[model samples]
Target: MKATRLNLAPWLFLAPFLGIFCLFTVWPLLRSFILALQQTYGPGTTEWVGLHNFRYLLTDPLFWTAAANTGRFTLGSLFVQLPIALGLALLLNRPGLRGRGFFRLTFFAPSLVGLPFVAMLFAPILEKRTGLINATLHRLFPIWDPEFAWMQEYVMSSLILAALWMYAGFNMVYFLAALQNVSKDLIEAAEIDGANAWQRFRHVTLPEIAPIAGFVTLLSVIGSFQMFELSYILLNNTAGPENRGLTIMMYLYQSGFVVGDLGYASAIGWVLALTLMGIALFQRWAARRYEER
Candidate 1:
């Protein structure tokens, strides 16, 4: 009996977390999965319709559009955000850079701002007239039309720019940590072997931090897919002109709340979850293959 009690004590201590996790996270996920298999009209009004929601989703054009937008954002993060963060991290990691703390803080301040706040702040700044960005562009190049509607004309690009400003610093912090962990001795040995700066970084620093880089990439991809608040707040809760900025999450929100199709929304959520899981698995496999090579 004493041995059994001792064994149960650990679970006793873990009970709060386990209970909360089951009630909040696990339960909701399970409920959503079940809901996705049903047809919902209102609260407490649902009819089981197995596989119907999934079938409709596969045929839905809006679903495909949302997926494309999300894919674009994910690709932009990989191609644009990653390189910029790495470059800034490398620059700040230099041996004798002055006022490094201030520079880091300046760059990282945007990430500290809440997503809604960032969107609200940029809305006025990107406005056609009396906007900071247009005003500056007018001052810099008077030949060009200053009244260009950026959010309307370049919907995804505009969002990408805002995202770049918001997340570059966040990713830079990770890269900076990775850069610091790189051994100075290895770098010096590479230099002694007549390796150039790029060669040393390519051979020594990059390989050492590749795991962290991969982790950052995975996180960025997940965040891109989950983007809703920024576009919602920026585009005034409407998917931008032509639905260019419409993302899967935003569509899910609309279908579940606006259209009162809770079952459909739940289905969208599961599709997103499955897609993210597949991408994460692929990333893990790719990372392992790279390491082996």
Candidate 2:
């Protein structure tokens, strides 16, 4: 009985977490999948619709638009955010850097602010007439139009900028942590072998942090796909002019709550999940191929 109790102790301690995970995450996922196959007519009224929801999804132009916007945002995140974050991490990782701690805090503080807070803060800044952005641009380039509506005309670009401001530092923290784990001896050896700064980074430091880099890339992809709050709040819960800022999550929310099409929303949710899974799997496979090479 004592041996049995000892074996069960670990599970007993894990029970709370496991229970909450199932209740919140696993169960909702399963429920969504089920609902995706049905036609929801209210809270309690639902009829089995088989795969019609998915069939509709295949031809939905709005869905495609959302997918394209999401893809653009994800690509922008990879190209923009990762490079900046990694650069900052590398810069701050240099030996004897002054005020490293302060720099890290400064970069990371934006990420600590919630999405709603960020939206609220940037709203007035991006406004057409009295906004800071337009006013500054007008001062810097007097030829430029001072009445430019950034939030509407350049919706995706604006959203990307906001996302980068919030997440670049977060990724920097990851890269910094990864950089710390790189062996100093290896870097020194590379230096002694006449490898220049860029060469050293390309071979020694990069290989050491490849795994963490991959992880950060994965996280950025996921975060881009899950982008809703910032765009929603910033765009005033609308999809912006021509639905340019309509992410898959925003579309799903509109379908689920705004339009009262829970079944269709669940189907959209499944598609998003599947898309994320596919991209993640492909990324892993590519990383494996790179490692093998």
Candidate 3:
């Protein structure tokens, strides 16, 4: 009886969490899967479609466009944003740096600002003639074009830049923490072995921080794939000229809410979920392989 009661106690404590998870997470997930397999006219009407939605998604040009744009943004985040984040973290991690706290705060402050606020903040700054960017460029270089249409013409570039500003510092915090935990003894040993700065980082520091780096990379990729709000607000709630800024999430939003096609939206959502899961599994496998090496 005591053993049974002990077991029951743990379950009793976990009852609230389990109930909430089943109600919110599990039910929603199951419903979405069911919705993906049906054709819905509205919230009330659904027709069994089997695999039709998935088949249609394959031939959907707009879906492909969104996928391509999302891929590009993901690549940009991985290569560009992450490196900049690591560099900033490295710079800030240095000992005897003057005003380290102030610099850290200054860099990280942008990330604290919400996406809508960031969008509004960058709107004018990215504008053409009188905007801060083009105005400064035109002032510095007489030949530079002040009338460049960033939002309309260079949509993805603008989004990437905006993301860089907002997220670089946030990612830096992770790298900074990882850097702080790196072994000073190993670093000093490398130095004493006549290893240069780059060599020391490569041999000792990098290996120590590689796990954190991988985690951060996974987070960045996931975030980039899920990007919507900044692009939506920046492009004025449109997909930008020629659908240049159209992302997978944005497409899902348009389908589910705007176009009133909940079924199709569920299909897209499942695809995204599966893709993220695959990427996560791949990252885990790669990390294990790297650790083995």
Candidate 4:
């Protein structure tokens, strides 16, 4: 009787959260998936059309381009952002770094500044005519006549740098937390023997925090795909000249809201959900394998 009561108490306590999740997340997902296979146009008119939307997606050039752009952004963040973040984490993790508190605040302040502020600040910095970047370049080098439109040609590069600036420190905070939990006694023992910094990191610290690192990687990938507000607000939703910043989310917005292709937009969203789930599962598998090894 006591065991039954205890089990029921937990479920009773969880009822509100479970009810909310089902009402919001689960219901919307299932509804969207159903809508993806049906033509959703003109009020009260939904025609069931299986595979047609998928066929359209397979043949769409812009869909392919958007996928490519998203992939590039994800990869670019991994390449640039992860390394810089990890480096900062390492530097901060060191035994005696001067003014650590001040540096931590300065580094993380950019991320805390929020998207609206970042966009407002960077819009002026990257404006082709009067941008600070071009101004400095022209002042330093007479041959550097950047008559080419920065918005058109350098949108991808500009967004990647912005993403790195906004996110790297946030990621560093995670790494810093992970590193601190590491067994200091083990690292000292490793140091006593002939292990160098890289050796200690690889053999001691890295393994200890492998799970956190893997989780952070998955987070970064997921976050990259969900990139929207920055480009939408800053680049004016065109991905800044030639749709170079047109992420999958932005594309979904264009289709669903701007163009009013509700059916096609739902299909895109369904695919995105599936993609995120797949990535998450794959990351889990990879992490499991790493642990096994």
Top of the candidates by lDDT: 3
The segments of candidate 2 whose C-alpha lies over 4 angstroms from its true place after superposition are: none
**What TM-score, over all chains together, does every model reach?**
0.95, 0.94, 0.96, 0.90
Cα RMSDs, all models: 1.5, 1.7, 1.5, 2.6
Steric clash count of candidate 1: 0
lDDT of 4 by residue, 71-177 (tens): 88899888899889888988998987898888887888799988767877787777775788777888788677646455567776777878888889999999899
- For TM-score, candidate 2 versus 3, the one ahead is 3
Off by over 4 Å in 4: 1-16, 42-45, 141-143, 146-148
Clashing pairs in model 2, backbone N/Cα/C closer than 3 A: none
Q: Write the per-residue lDDT of candidate 2 for residues 1-293, one digit (tens) a residue.
A: 99999999999999999999999999998899889998876557788999999999999999999999999999989999899999999999999999999999999999999888898888888889689988988899998788997898888878788888888899999999999999999999989999999999999999989989998999899989988988899988799889998999999999988887799999998999898999899989989998998
Cα deviation of 281 in candidate 4 (Å)?
A: 1.1
| Backbone clashes counted, model 3 | 0
Residue range 1-293, candidate 1, lDDT tens digits = 99999999999999999999999999998899889998887656888999999999999999999999888888887899899999999999999999999999998999999889999999998888788888898899997577888888877777888899999999999999999999999999999999999999899999999999999999999999999988889999899998988999999999998888899899999999999999999999999999999
Where model 3 places Cα greater than 4 Å from the true spot, the runs are: 1-9
| TM-score, cand. 1 | 0.95
User: Which ten contiguous residues of candidate 2 have the minimum total lDDT?
Assistant: 38-47
Instruction: Choose 2 or 4, whichever is better by lDDT.
Output: 2
Residue clash pairs of candidate 1:
none
The CA lDDT of each predicted structure is 0.92, 0.91, 0.93, 0.84
